[model samples]
Target: MLIDAIRIYCQKNGIQLSTRDKTLAADFFEHPHDYISDDYFNYKLHSFICRSHAELPEIFIVEEKGNDFLVYERIISDFCCLSQHKQQAPQSFIGKKIIILREQPKTLEAEALYATIKKRISGANLFFLPLVAFSLLLPFYSNLFNSRLVYSSSLTSVLYITIFFIFFALLEAFLKTSVYKTVVRATHDNSIKISKLLMYILTITSDDSAPSTTRAIELSSVSYWKAISSLMVDVALLLVFLICIVLLLGEYSIILFLYYLGFAIFCVYARFQSYESSLKSIAINNDRLIDSISLHNNRQQVRFTNFDTLRHAFYVKSLASEKLSHQLDLHNNRWAEILKLNTFISMVLMYIACYLAINTGSLSIATIIAVMIINSRLSAAMIASVNGCYSVKVNLHQIKASLTKLTQHIVLANANQLHLDKIEQLTLENITIEPHGHATLAGYNANFTRGNVVGVVGKVGVGKSTLLRAIIAQAALPHGAIRYNQVNIHNIDALTFQRQIAYYQPALQFFKGTLRFNFNLYGIHDTGRILAIIKYCCPAMTVDINILDDVDADALNFSAGERQKIIISMLLEKQPSLIILDEPTSFMSDDEGLDFLRHLIAQHHDAIFIIASHNADVNRIATTLINISNTGKHKKIFINTPRPTVPITVKPQGGLAE
Candidate 1:
């Protein structure tokens, strides 16, 4: 159990060990109590060596704590120079606890994770209350137009109201800035968690029905609170303004309010009718525009065809189509114009009502003007409230759909099960590979053992790469089972199984960072091993030892062959148990390709190699060959020869030079 914890920690942290050290560590773990001097054992074992030591020993200590184990490491300096007597004595050393081996924490569901973020940012909603309250003061402005007060008193009143308005407006602005900053900080802090959630979803989802990257990002960063808060604030302000209007102008205000309410209902209905159609047209046009831009960026293809004319015409056409879509949507949705017309009609009715009230001696001129001002403000608030409600409904629907898609195909792992230490045999039992349209391959059975190089050969579009994907569990196998050491791949821990496998394809990408980062992305940081592999695979290329040079802007400077060689070298440095290569030497010359195959067959003889290629030389070097036909049938050919168990040195004579 202690050995398993140490091995898992090393794999996760990218630590590599030599063959001798692995054997020694395994033996020590089996008889750990024999080496300990204490009577109680203390559930602690120390002095186990790992890969981090040079002349001195790097000791690993494991302490059992209930169901889990805590692992620590300590480096002893100049231990070789110490006297034998001193080495025999009991030594005490402090170690740094590196990791704990326990059940991984259960990942929170997408809805639950979103709710936690919403709760943290919900404090920003309180700021809307003050903003709505400040808006209530707009109705009071009608007092300034009154003629009863003296000039000096009226001027003083205007000055005080202006001051209050400015103060409240500034306060609202400050609160808005604070909320913006808070949201930004929260988003930044939770970015890693959000990324993990996205990866988890992708890992468990089928390849054919995976969600788009843009949609996933949108769902991960959705802020429904913005629309909800806006709706609530507008509704509250509209209600308060209506109440004030009713209190000031009794029956007339009620009649005007009812009229506006009916108009608002009509406006909402029109908006709903036009909203979905507008969005669909815009989305389609946007996709077309994006495609045109991507085509334009590929200057090579266009230059060979029409010398920039085709790209220019395509972009122009897409842009015009997008503009037309936008114009049509705006023309169809006339809710904003309808609201403006309602305001104008309400103003005319208010003037008529005021004239009647004044003639009947029911209201003074100043009071009538105040009622007109309140009515106008109420109409404006009602428009905003209706728009806010529409926005909230649209956003809520989108969020609900995104969340449902995210959780629909989730595959949860059993935390109580322990991972396998090593994968000895992989068996594919009557597997069917259904990547997309039709079933590419079906009823295929194969068994792969350690130290066997299996070559898969097929013509273009014959599902060679798909077969490799199925083996690694990246592509779905609908009609069969893939087992690792007799256990189904799905039942095993995904991370643990992936750690023992390395996959290389023709379309592998490098990130926009230093070469060191790209090389050590999987945690193998042995400088000597990396330099050696680079020298052997790419003899003509030169690079810095620290590898601080950027590979972003000038990545194209490296030829395709050079990039493939560098990526292959990095993969070999990991020393994974299973290596899957798909058309690995498509960019290399025949001589270079042959040399690459010879080198792999010689070195790393203990690993299981699955190479898919059309090169005849690759088939000649393999112990077993699988030929896939056009009808999705496969024929397995076995070469009756002993598998090579010793490493041999081979050098490339051509290709990958400069």
Candidate 2:
């Protein structure tokens, strides 16, 4: 029983014993049979090690006949002086351990994945309360305030009533827009205010959190289907209400009949307007979902940047104005077909009513015409509204589902950080970074110090940028323990950490603003620091700084080095605790590149510098050099120090010289 307990404890705690870690394993084994190796055990054991050699050790104890034997144990810590990952990769032992591993989907399977997502979201039920309320009320309003052309007061009374209703219509528009805004706010957060509905089409698309083209198309398809269902539900309810109103108001005289018909027509117009407003909300909300995904992923790549692009991609322009128009036109053609059918039925009924009236000597044609008009309007309106409501209902459900999924992802990301915290240095232990099928940084450890220079150098495909990405984002890392001052970064706000550990990659991007605008991206205002870094990185100002205010028609015109300098300068202004420079000097001349590096080291001494490069100059400046290479089943790492050397200059003869 004693041996079994020890073995069980080791397995649960991911304990392992190696030839080198035998003493560490024995220290754990020293505990009595009944001793519990819970959090207390971990704390006690962790406390036993020196601060310099302190590590999170995993010791494994295997059970044999009536005895507990040490299987293996390893004490791992950041290899700041060695390679990218200094931690043991437990995933490598998957076949001998866990039953299954999650496999990444192939790019070819993306379309199928999209379809599955659509089906799931489409199936979820959506609520359309506002549409339901509007549909129900519209019928009653149509009956009570029906429009009538007066034959008594000439055209004067008719004109007066028309103008009065126009005022009423304007009031309705204002009130509805206000109400829609309030609803949008309640459904979303403080970010979207009630006033946003006024220009909902324009403004919402401009939100930084809106989705890009790739995700939007997927979301839009789901939205389109959901809208259809909601529209059907709304139209069905309205049709029943309209039918009830028409039957009740049919007893009124001819003038009243005309008025009711006109009122019903006006109500139809209002329904269209409301549908348009709801569409704007849907567009804005869908984009928000996409933005949330990108933000959570921490992808610098921006997808759909504008509504025009989104609108076109979603087929919104053609669908609403063309496809929908065609559908409506076809419905109208069907209306002609259905109207003929209804008119024939009514004609037969009228003939019977007339015959009966003639025999009783009391009926008139005037009465027959009024009854027919109400009957025709009620039937036509019912069919149109119900069809429209179905479309809206389907879209509403899809939008809700998409948002719900996004919300879940956000919650999970937050939960992962609940136990993580932020500090000066981050250490990874026994980490495996799988960058590709054949390439990975396995069993690697690295330490990043605060306000110090650390350089990462390796051959091609060594997961340099991947390491930086993983540190800034927990979700971004394939697998690792990123510690911020000994606390796992998983417990801290990833966004805040990212901001603190800024990365500058040599990518081309220019904003639609002055040079000052680009520098102020993070809302930074230190102009003095900006100009200084710029001067150091690009002494010549290369592409003419004089055109800083000129509208940049083409960003490609600027040299790659100049673009990198601007980006680095912006990052400098951001003043992150850890700054990652990924091949920043890749495009600069040797003289300019050296100048850039010297400036970075001098100006940002307060920041921990991690540069991924193979430049001899960079290697010489790096406080530590870690090499990453993969062999057979596991990854290998080597740590070395920068050798002291003077500047190596090119001789006229091109012979070896130092």
Candidate 3:
């Protein structure tokens, strides 16, 4: 099956079979399992197949029968290979024999993956235990030779101990390096999985419910490093605490042991309190800063007197944020001082304990020295561990919060076998339109077919836009189903369904790019048709035929009416089956708006045109008018005879849709 898919792809792209290495192809086919198991072998075979090409292939075909192995039409790009093409670009693969491969089987859920990473980090941290033991025992062992307490001073004994220490230290270093590399590689691989999962969540989530663009990026990329660092510190601290316990058992000094243990516990408690307070302060400061920045950014939108008031408010927020930040810094400094004082006290107690042990002859001179050294190390490790635990707590809290926000409102729907070449006979079976959880339109039933113009009219905030959003599957329909050719809209693949739609709103903005780039944003590259449409829409506005001029900056150097016309022209260039417009002519003059509407209706006579507007002229031009009341009910106001609800039969295609 994979071979057949690859053959079809090559044939469609006009790649000659004579160019392919027949020997490599035979090897790939005969021992397909071997190639599947070995990524290097698979890459060698696929590379030979596309050796004649230059640009990397955007589509990949994978065998579904056994171990899924991808065959690229061109050489794979670095990013594609690194990400493993986890999310397929459905539109790019449309009309091509491309098989969408599943991501690696070991990919876990976001939370599970985080847990696994933590476990691996902890395992890697175990390598530090031996090193910690060596450090603690070294002082005692070295002092033993100097004092001649445990063994008599001799060259053989000294040499034997020196070699053993050297050999063990080197062995430990190598083991640590190997374990660290393994953990690092695993973490890198899992980070990609986390990113993919987060992207998928963002794609499926509605814009209103999703995180801000900055926050999404932070969660997907920035948080991975923070998480790994925090986990390492957390695990290291745990190992330190365990070593402290071992020291207590070996020394048989309960008082000293309890003192250090109590100090470690106190540090943890103090740090947790400080971190919680600091986090709250940081959040408040961030909110204030954002408020001030937002006010300044939108100063142009405010009136002169209003702008003065907003400026004052912005100053107040800025001052508050600065003050809060300063206070937080002071608080952190105070905690640092307290920690230092505790450490000093801890060292003093250790010195007094050692002096008593020496006076009572309960411990040897070497043992006293070792205790002093271990006490100092334990004090430092405890302090470091407290900070690490705080960081781990905060990072995990953020990750969990982001996961909850994304998952809470997601509505899971099964993939269905419905594809539409051209949408015809759109039926709204008692749909309840709701935007942002507020019901705006209830039990609205409508059937639209080709050659019909639908005008939706309503008062301000009366749900005209919400109705349109419901039709496009952007807003949720809690009560009913929207069907295209007798199949539910939800059942149709989104990419395939949207291909036949051209939805335009007055709020839509263009990316910062040239006219050609904007026009070709939706895969429409006919320069002649684009120029013709621009000419037709705005005759007075002469645009470059080559369309190399940049329009996104300063609203493309066009007036509001001109920009609207250009946007309309861009939409018209799509030649979509369903055209949805919301207050599309709000910026244009009445006569020009009516004229444009007439031209649009005439040019797309066979298409379904749905326009939501308050203009009487639009109502006059429309065949069916839906009047939505402020109470969220729809009243049909027919302007002309509606088209017959005849379903257009389209052949269903298998697999996923574009």
Candidate 4:
């Protein structure tokens, strides 16, 4: 349990591990963090012992029928040390046993994300609203001119309106540039916010035991872009719509104004109904295909369901969508009937008003013609604006739903400032990881104080990747502690902690962007570093390493090996303190993989590395190798000793490192 680990950690630190400290530990476990100082976690020990893997004693916790239930190195407190996990446990594992010597995690808020979008959209409206007001007033020039053409007065009025339009056009041009920049900036800012949430979600939901599957969290990769893309257009149209309404009432009759409002409402409502049906259709179809696509992307060859089966399933979903569309269309058609009634009422009102004016000799045929033209133009603008507003509202509501779904599962970085500048060491103490309640790895004990290449070797299905994820995240322990420096990782902010650690798994994807974009993610802009990475990854290409103009050559187009190399190169450029690779070089050629590692080891000798691979040759490079067993037991082997080596083939028949 984390309370036990804390007592041990406190014992080593010589801090008074009081009974109140136990209460603090319990509270910290439930909350994960409770605002402790970084210095409180300093794990600098006074004494340590080094021994061969075989010489180390295995400490068993429980036994059944004389079988080992849990086994690891004994807690020789005077010399005990543990590896560090740099972040907090997932939101799902709130009460699980793990060292969480920090403050409680706060809920991620969608309001913060929406506020950024709102600020930008509001700024754009400042420029657009005034232009729309002037455009709406353009049709009311009849009020300025004489009813019958006084030639001089009419010409003057026409010239005055033209100059007014030209003046507003100039203002529009001035604001357009600023508005465009603001929109782009806001979209980019929103992308960063969504990206943060995506990462947080991935961290919590990486394990099967997670409350939900977030591996290919559909929201992370695509939704924000869709939400932000059409926002400005909607805002502009809405401004124009409102301005048109005001102008209608000012230039025409109350009846005409009412007619315009009613027509615009019906038009927007009908369009919104159809738009809603399409949204439902899209959502249904996405649900139908998402699992198959996710499985295919994961590179799993196992056939769960057949192609014809998928086809039939999609057919069923499509039928539902079609039915939904039909229902919406029926409702719209009914509204269309109401619109006909509205048009009849408007026509009758127009005739009465026009008849009264004509009889009073106040309106001429020319003036009536002029009024009709203005009404026609005014209705089009009003309808356009209303439809735009409705579209944006629907999109925003959908996006907010997605955000809410994700925020519930993960705890994001707190508003309170935190930073993990570097990863100096890692410590793990008697940690048992039973993912989905299947005890794949148990009683794993290791002290990696001086960061070095650490490897886990085991047979197929013996939880090598599972253990690696335990250290690298995606899998949280049920008991014990994984601390970095001295602070429980569960107390540290996930994103801040992640900044100091680089994790690469084969299933991860890169963005569809330029070479510079991939490399520039860590805010490192060293030209030499980028050139070195590009030269190693893609030697055959003649493209400029830094400013590769091929923007379209993103993740989809790149080969598997190419994508892997690009990600590795990005990690190398950033030079994080801890580098974790789970089959990272699996896609690369043997020679290519070796060459990349040679460069990596040379540059990043100080960083801690946890590499899990099937290749025996890969494990031979590690300073210490831990052999994982099928019964969730571990055996340590010191490979870097001075002894004559005899090669033996290690197969996947049983859980052994050989």
Candidate lDDT scores, in order, read 0.61, 0.49, 0.61, 0.55
Clashes of each: 0, 60, 2, 19
| Cand. 3 TM to true fold | 0.68
Q: Of the candidates shown, which would achieve the greatest TM-score relative to the real structure?
A: 1
lDDT of 2 by residue, 1-658 (tens): 3344444444444332222223333444443222331111111111121111111123332222454222333322111111123343432222222111111112112233334333432222233333344433433333323433523345787677567656666666666566556544433321121112112222213234423432443445544544444454545554554554344433332333354355446545544444544455555545545645655554443353565564465464335445444544564565457446645654455455445554565544344444344445554555456446545454544444444443233222332243222247767776776655434566678787766677777667767777766766623654557777777665665444535666766664666576656655544334455566567655665544454446652333556777777777766654567777888788887777777887778877777788886576887777776555654254344559786587677789997568
lDDT tens digits by residue: candidate 4, 525-606: 4455666666667677654643554464453355678778877767655567788888877887776676666677778888
Which residue pairs in candidate 1 have backbone atoms (N, alpha carbon, C) closer than 3 angstroms, thus clashing? none
**For model 2, what is the alpha-carbon lDDT of residue 617?**
83
Worst 10 residues of 3 by lDDT: 47-56
**Which stretches of candidate 3 lie above 4 Å from their native place?**
1-96, 101-191, 203-252, 289-293, 303-305, 319-327, 359-370, 406-408, 430-445, 476-481, 511-521, 524-558, 565-575, 598-605, 629-658
Q: Which pairs clash inside model 3?
A: 496-658, 551-556
List, residue by residue over 445-465, the lDDT tens digit for candidate 3: 889999999999878876788
Q: What lDDT is reached at residue 373 by model 2?
A: 47
| Residue-level error in angstroms, candidate 3, position 444 | 5.3
| lDDT per residue (tens digit) for residues 1-658 in model 1 | 5555555444443332233243435554444333321111111122322223221123333333464444333212222111112331112222322233222324435566445444533456666666666665544555643543434555787677678777877887787678667755544444444454566566565433234532544553454555555666777777877887667666666667778778788878876775665555544554565665567657567657875676687677676767767666585556667766887899887787667667777667777666766787778777777777766566555544455555665656664443565678888899775444345567878898899899998777767898888788776666898888888877777444545677889988675576655655644345566567666766777845644343452343567787787787677665667888998898999789878877876777888899998677888889898776576434454579986677555549644432
On TM-score, who's better, 2 or 3? Answer: 3
